[model samples]
Target: MSDYFHNKRIVVTGGAGFLGAYILKGLQDRGCGHILVPRIEDYDLVRPADIERMYDDMQPDVVIHLAAVVGGIGANREHPGEFFYKNLMMGVQLIEQARLRGIEKFVAIGTICAYPKFTPVPFKEQDLWIGYPEETNAPYGLAKKMLLVQSQAYRQEYGFNSIFLLPVNLYGPGDNFSPASSHVIPALIKKCVDARDSGADHIECWGTGKASREFIYAADAAEGILLATERYNGPEPVNIGAGFEIAIKDLAEKIV
Candidate 1:
């Protein structure tokens, strides 16, 4: 760890986002001197011209792409087209432009949702393409999965340096708790907290509580991303997690 990121001018596409916030802190902690976070309002990454403009303005030596149109199952079902199109366009265009600009490295953040619907317990990185993803969020997952394809392709063809990382369900402070699109952990916590504040005897939850998931603290996930950015340059994607899984029923009991 010779301060690989200390002097590099890094650009994080979604630097204002939940995970992006922690990534910014990680970079700062690493003594990075120049880190640019492109806000979507300022630079709409889905558009190719804006991506080029971002490159011209930031002049980054490295790029860590964390921007994505994400949501829980409900949101995914409601806006599959938007999720697929936006996430796909943003990543594809950004990576292409970054390559053309000759950025030293690119770090693409992917999702565990990209795993197959029936991936065996303790999913392995090699099982990514064993089958199609879970139907609920397949569009978003597949969209992000293309980044891996692009990363490997560009690496082999043009010698572009890029890496992909897959992080599992993320939960911690600042987690989204919106009823319309929050993930399991935050949604569960919110329900419990709201019930307690209102003095309700019980709260209702969806599903049979049979599902299982693995979550990484947002800060831990950020550190993993930064480490991969500094150290990993391989063709395969890496999984970032706590290396454990828990059942939803068990998790709910613990929260209660």
Candidate 2:
């Protein structure tokens, strides 16, 4: 509903990814025409030279750094090093590059997993440093959390207008449905649909289904990101969550 982004040259890394694709579509729908997307094949973000090449080519007004190695608890537990290395390199390289190029704005996407594992319900942004993250996701979460630190420091020393957004679990269409890579909602939807179609009496789920989570529809997350870009600019990271939490079992039942 806002035209603040009109004619802006926005470069969204990982534009082919699940969340990145939705953000790109939202920008297009809101009259943003000069949207530049660089997929992994186009540029390896972990490599500084590739990122430099992209900044030289695009020269965008804003850089939305959404590229990373993401997965559910299972995947994170299995690939800790890959999760840490890829995410850290991508965030560090991209933000530094954007700052060097004098980009007007840089939007870094953070995650709720950055909060401490024992963080109280309704996790606050200031609570990010209270304790360590959940063991399963510490590597991946900490990697992205570094962006928040970099953004703040850049703003302090370099006067760069970089902002970080922390979003909770996101789900919608265009999500990865593969069991190995998918998040809770899509994975459950796929499993439930398949099991129902196959006449299974019951399907088991992980973690007792009592662990609560907050999920935002992908479209809403995109809208929130754009809104933050236009109205909010500050050093501390802002949470873009739905403000409502649900038990995993309840979410699975809704899908069923």
Candidate 3:
């Protein structure tokens, strides 16, 4: 590890989250100190006043905006308005506040779901605005997509240094395994483990198990984020992926 971020104050909004924790670990490994993590219980990102106070207190050199209301299809469907409002408000407030505070660099994490549902396979960064996102995840996805737009605008107008990254479905340890809000990988792992423990012959999954998806380990995604922070300094968003795709059924089989 280099001293690039040594003793530099960094603030990760969702430091306790799955992907956020991995990103935090990467920053720590690079010698970062004075890391401030404000949990939702302590500070809600949706509130402008709280965000303003965080900027005043932490004064982070780099702000990684990862705090948001995230979940799978069922959760999104159940709480569409909350997902949209919380995520949109948090992102807009955090990035705008960071710009006003004159932060050195800002890293915004986008999602693949931001692309249109019918977008071409092997989705490219350019395909982001091709059409509407999938109904189940449109609100959550678009909320994050707005940050990319803000990044470009800020860079061009105010000369703010901000980069956006779109990472594919992420998994690994420390992932949320609750069936109500968990993503596919961890949910499947829990299900398989339980089924095997019960000696069940088979387990049933949703959606005909035909949809294809790309998966990235949480650690790998963090590496990509930091690498982009160090080497990539463009306004265009970069897609961090595993470079391979798999069907849902195939992925479950491999997990089992």
Best by the TM-score measure:
1
TM-score of every model versus the real structure: 0.98, 0.97, 0.96
For candidate 1, the per-residue lDDT at 250 reads 90
Badly placed stretches (over 4 Å) of model 1 are none
Residue 61, candidate 3: alpha-carbon lDDT: 91
Candidate 2 per-residue lDDT, tens place, 58-147, comes to 889998888878887679989999999999999988999898888999999998989999988887888899999999899999999999
Local error of candidate 3 at 132, Å? 1.1
Instruction: Sort the predicted structures by lDDT, highest score first.
Output: 1, 2, 3
The candidate with the higher lDDT, 1 or 2, is: 1
Better of 1 and 3 by lDDT: 1
For residue 72, give model 1's deviation from the true position in Å: 1.3
Residues 164-184 of candidate 1: C-alpha lDDT, one tens digit per residue: 999999998888999889999
In TM-score terms, candidate 1 sits at: 0.98
Question: lDDT for model 3, on a 0 to 1 scale?
Answer: 0.89
